[model samples]
Target: MLLRKPAASELSAEPILSAAENYSGEMHAIDTGVRVDAVEFARGRVALGRLLAKRGIGYGDRVVMAVANGPLFAAALCAVLARGASPLILHAKTPAAEMRRYAERYAARMVFGDGSSETEYRETGLEPYLVEAADWARLLCANVKIVDESAGNVSLVLPGVPLHPTSGTTGQPKVALRPGRPAIAEAAHYIETTGIQASDTILVAAPQSHAYCYGMGTMVPLLCGASIITMRGFEAGLVQSALRDTNVTVVPAVPAMLGSLMFGTRGDLFARVNTVFSAGAPLNEKTAKAFANKFGIAVRPLYGTTETGGIAISLPGSQAVAGICVGPAMKDVEVDVRDDGQGLAPGLGMTYVRSESMMTGYLDENGLDQSFVVDGWFKTGDIANQDTEGRIYLHGRQSEVINVAGMKVIPSEVENVLLRISGVIEAKVYSREHRTGSQSVQAAVVAHGVDDADVRAHCEKNLVYYKRPSMISFVEALPRNATGKIDMAALSNL
Candidate 1:
């Protein structure tokens, strides 16, 4: 399933904006029904690009887009890319402090924001392209022609730079950057891997700032000529309404959002959603099974990183299985398991990747370097075993692996078994050093009507004695980060 690289000229000339031209003339986007066309989209982007250029934005300059999901956000991003400047998109809901740090770290020259964000930027003495009130109409109606000559070079000067954040519950999130070649390759791989087509209508509920939303939610749909339904934010009711209203066929969401749609909302939220892809964190088998049983549709668990792009490994709707075996490597990508920094036999040790879509490097105060790889393969911190069939089963991060009496215990393995208990909602297991100079496993669980005895009994049936938790702590709910991943650092403090 190797994807031959298409020439840059062919890709650039391809009608990415044709959906707005040839498709439905009156389509509902956000709160308005607007007719779209390639010409109009082109015109809008040119107008915005010209404005950005006049404001001193040039090729290779970083323009931070801190806007919400909508037509403007899409147009602005495409405009920036088309004009030869790199757009550094940040989640609109990201904390002001974090956003400021990203802008400073990247040395972004200008920022595009809505009214609320404009206020925040103003206090920081930064100029913001505030797209609210009269400015919105002015910017969109500028009528500047986008000159094709300014498309600039496809190759980036910095090549790979951290464009998105990883789900870090330990401390400040780690950012990974994929270069142009790998980024485009990964985007294409995701579309091919999922069998996404021009006819598929994708419902994007994740924030446009996140990689899942930005790549799958925006880039793939455009590249594949699929219609995208963008939501301002995730509300269980809004998701249900959009599912029915838009005839959305495919949905990519985090587990937290899926859990809410499956149990929090009643009356056929999944009725129109044929394929549901869940990622960003591990999905427990119980939740996956329950969703499938209730919705009569498979909940496909996907695995990847911002550095890697969308769904590197995923089960298709037809081959979906319960729990987290994130299928196999996508087309044009390779996955290997390693032990002691050497490639291991199939189905054992740490997972390593060598793919067209892998990130180039990480950029920080110290500048960028190829941080996570040895030779050519990028060592994914995740520990896993791949079956002969090539299905990958994740066993948690290597940093989190516990050594109990010299035998390694992966916390996710224990937590998976614990989550299957009747009343257990969420569980986290980790290793702690004991006074006796041995490492012992501790479990933190969020349950309803399930006590330590019940959880212990459940684990006893599924796990070996050496893998069982030495102690269990109960919490009303597990703390999660902004991306809805469990906050392990916060949990450690608890």
Candidate 2:
């Protein structure tokens, strides 16, 4: 395992929820079809923490949350942190079996959100708590801590920051633990780079499960005392509506979401947006140009990995794209290219980084193919070249980390799922680029009896929307080359 918990704090730091309450009452969070002020959001965390405390959850306990992006989700995360219980925050659409596996592995105290089976958890001493939106909101209003602001002085003691999930070649999920020490600094960095003002209303339109969105959208905005507008997920029409309704100034979105919103009929929707920042995947050249032409602004790229969070981000008024450039590294991030022993000026090689919030490595697994860290630098498997001005341009990845929309899909993970099918003999999954300049998951399977639909259905059970194969082809055999190995070239042709 590559994960190591940060040194435990002896003296109490300030409680995250209490710090959040320092935001002015005028600051609000909009999501789940309702609006609540910043104090109320903080109060929600306080009250939820009280409830967890009452239920015997204490410091260092693990809470599994499967939540969508919204104010409640953000507040719940804060509640876990305030109570000193680290969260294993899962995507709302995570499969039930995977949730169970995580719960069992960690011996989770509670599971919150959808797709968690009550029966499976009953045996593991795990408690399942389905989030009641109305209840959390009501609890927000009912928090006694908010009534007496003196309670803000007592800080919450965390064992560490919350955890992030990463997958290996075998497709078994592992937790990547980040250091809590750099979290607040990274949040402040976003505020400094973006020039977020007290009155700015940042939009949390992307998935909160992403470290970027959670840090930038939830954490930074709260620290800056800025308001936020969020939706569950990005739909072109829904996002357009939120933009109009909220007059959203700053948007944290992925390239695919931007492509969908821009290419559609909703023109002039981005007029109010001060900036559109994209991460999760590289913004395609075609998408960037179209956005700049239509909106009179470039879609800036925010590049990083699940392991190393926020390596580089394009600040406001910065040019969004210049030959696949992802601007310069953000504050407190050191970037290096490990090309033999060459200098760090700029050449194609593996990207190495030492960042404020980078994870130690994967948890619960003994060893993996490549070491996540060397010396002190975290090895990012991206092929890149940096210009003299410090602008970095990505060529591609050294591994098969497929970027479908903005979500990272490990090819072997999908291939492993395919092989699980009863009639499947061999399976290979790869991405195919569409003319729209986006990628789709495609699979070629050597199987009998089961058709393409069956294979797809099986995938639907295990994988999320983006991870499922968009197209499936069943054949008598998978073509092999001179070495008697599966030929990805011939597979792509099929």
Candidate 3:
């Protein structure tokens, strides 16, 4: 576990429902054909609160939620918060056994999942709260007036907030525990920074379970009265179709999805889109330029981690200086780079950030560990530098840096060079360990009619000798995890 919690005295808890209550937007689902406005969503939230109360879920009790993305998921999130239950959201397809394990590991009071997962959860000896789209719709839009038992009560204390899981690219995944005040503060900052409006319709193709989509796609927009259109998963055809059919002005996508959109038709494909935000992984210059050249739109690189909520984002129409630059620190957020004491430049080193919205700590099996944060800053484990213009340029994960004969090689730098070569569609660079205890740079490439020689030749022209890939393997596709990030652990086998 790389992160630990701060002291309990440093944490402050507030009700997250205050933000949800301010939402006057709408949620539209592509697959389920369910449209819920703010009023409907609130009604459903209150009703769901009753259901959770019946299940004996309340303040400080942890609940595991594996519901799929849609209006219902958003409602369920709010309802869980309303009942003052800390909620941990997992991937919708997570097996019932794994869900139960996480529940036990986290000491959750109950598990909430979609209708499809009900039987499996029951078979696992857990009576899960099954959320059906039809049932949710009826709860929200039904004509029957929902009686509120504690609508006027002011004594309730909400200490529960949403929890997130790390992507585990560096190691095993750990759960992030956050306070309600910081979580709501982060959502407000994101909504204000992005300028999300009531009239704008945002398209969400990324996994809603992830922090990026959960905040930017669902919470940010809804909290500010902006509508959202969600797709269960990202497919080029489906996403493009939704963009063409709907009036989606903002599209928050990962780099993988943006790269996939490069091969398809783009004749007015993004006619109505004025903003596009990319995160989760580094946005290679190839895809950035290609998307801009083809669609006449600039790709804003948003930078943050699940544990940090949101730290920085390139505003609309910001140009990438040198490489891709995730713009300056967001409002009320402080960002800086620390020197590694290895002769790095003045403003270039490990990225450290601190904000009210950052997570309180990491949840381990034993209990809360409060050691990750030093003083007030959290080490982000990323090699980054702030340009003179105050834009953030990421090198790569510090753990992903390759050491060859005591020299350093950033994989993202090498991968970017590979992507510049003709016919190269995807590229991932890593360090390969030899039996003699030395590491050599290796690359896995997905390209069209490109071989090792072509890759080497390009590297020779662009990268230093040690920085160039010593070995290259051409494959049809790169293996990716559920969150659209390349599975670094699985790359060593290649």
Better of 1 and 3 by TM-score: 3
Between which residue pairs do clashes occur in model 2? 2-361
Model 1, total clashes: 4
Best by lDDT: 3
Instruction: Judging by lDDT, tell me the better candidate of 1 and 3.
Output: 3
Q: List the candidate 3 regions with Cα displacement exceeding 4 Å.
A: 1-15, 115-119, 122-134, 137-158, 167-170, 319-323, 342-347
Our tally of clashes for model 2 stands at 1
- Taking all chains together, each candidate's TM-score versus the true structure is 0.82, 0.70, 0.89
What would the per-residue lDDT of candidate 1 be over residues 1-494, giving only the tens digit for each residue?
11223344322312333322333221135443443444455566667767767767676565556666656666776666655665666776654445556655565555565424545655655444533222232331111122222222212243112256664323346555544555556668887787877778787777767777677776676667677776667778777777767778888888878777875565476677668888888887777777777788877877886766653556655334446588887887788876754232244687778776766555444444454555657777777887788878777787787878877787887887887687888788877777898888899888899887887788788988989998899998778765677877787776
lDDT of 2 by residue, 1-494 (tens): 22333346411224344446676523333444667776566667677778767766678666777767666776777777777777777876665556656655655556665434656445444444443334434221111111222221112223535777765223445676554545555676677776877777788777777677877776777677777777666667777777777667888877657666765635677788887888766565556766788888777888877677778876555554432578878877888866854222245666888866666455552422125666668877676777787777775455555777777676655776787787776676788978888888888887878897888789889988988998898887767532123566788798
Q: Could you arrange the candidates by TM-score from highest to lowest?
A: 3, 1, 2
Please give the lDDT score at residue 376 for candidate 3.
Answer: 69
Q: How many residue pairs clash in each candidate?
A: 4, 1, 2
Q: Residue 14 in model 1: shift from native, Å?
A: 11
TM match of model 1 to true structure: 0.82
